[model samples]
Target: MTRQDISELYRGYIDCLNRQAWPELGRFVHQEAQYNGQRIGLSGYREMLENDFRAIPDLRFVIDLLIADPPHIAARLCFDCTPVGELFGLPVNGKRVSFTENVFYEIRDGRIAQVFSVIDKEAVRAQLGNDSP
Candidate 1:
């Protein structure tokens, strides 16, 4: 896929997530997808996303930055939401917090085959006033 093609595809994938269109996730995520290093297939991927939405009902993925390099995509996804309980093991407890996730994706056959993601947990911690360390 061309750089533009991959970027558009990624944007579409983000749109699908924002819509919470679980059924359409297969179009963007490979059946044998891997998250971080674990091989969490499409079903597991969907479940993870579902759990995220359940925790933060207002969760929305906003792309603050995006770079498409053929089969690879690097993105900075920003989030501003309130979590009902713990988020990344931090007690957000319905408090609004803003953070960014730096994620890299490897697209295979136009579907996401692998994902390496790191969320800004320290940002959440600071927001929650738990900055010990």
Candidate 2:
């Protein structure tokens, strides 16, 4: 895929997530997808996303930055939502928080094959008034 094609594909994937189109995820994610080095297949990936939505009812993925290079993509995804309970082990407790996640993906056969993501936990901690990192 060209750079533009990859970018468009990623945008579509983000849109699918925003729409909670679980059934359509396979179009973007490969059957053998890996998340953070864990060999979680497409079904596990869907389950993880479902759990995320359940935890944060108003969860929305906003792309603050996106760059596509052939079979690779790097994105900064921003989120502004309230979690029903603790998030990333932090006591968000239904409080509204805004944070960003820096994620990278490797595309294989025009689908996401590998993912590495890091969320801004310090930002959440700061918002929660917790100095301890």
Score every model by TM-score.
0.98, 0.98
Q: Candidate 2: misplaced stretches above 4 Å? A: none
Tell me how candidate 1 scores on lDDT. Answer: 0.96
Per-residue alpha-carbon lDDT of model 2 for 8-96, expressed as tens digits? 99999999999999999999999999999999999999999999999999999999999998899999999999998899889999999
Alpha-carbon lDDT, every model = 0.96, 0.96
lDDT value, residue 25 of candidate 2: 100
lDDT of 2 at 37: 99
Give model 2 RMSD, 1 decimal.
Answer: 0.7
lDDT score of residue 22 within candidate 1: 93
Candidate 2 residue pairs that clash: none
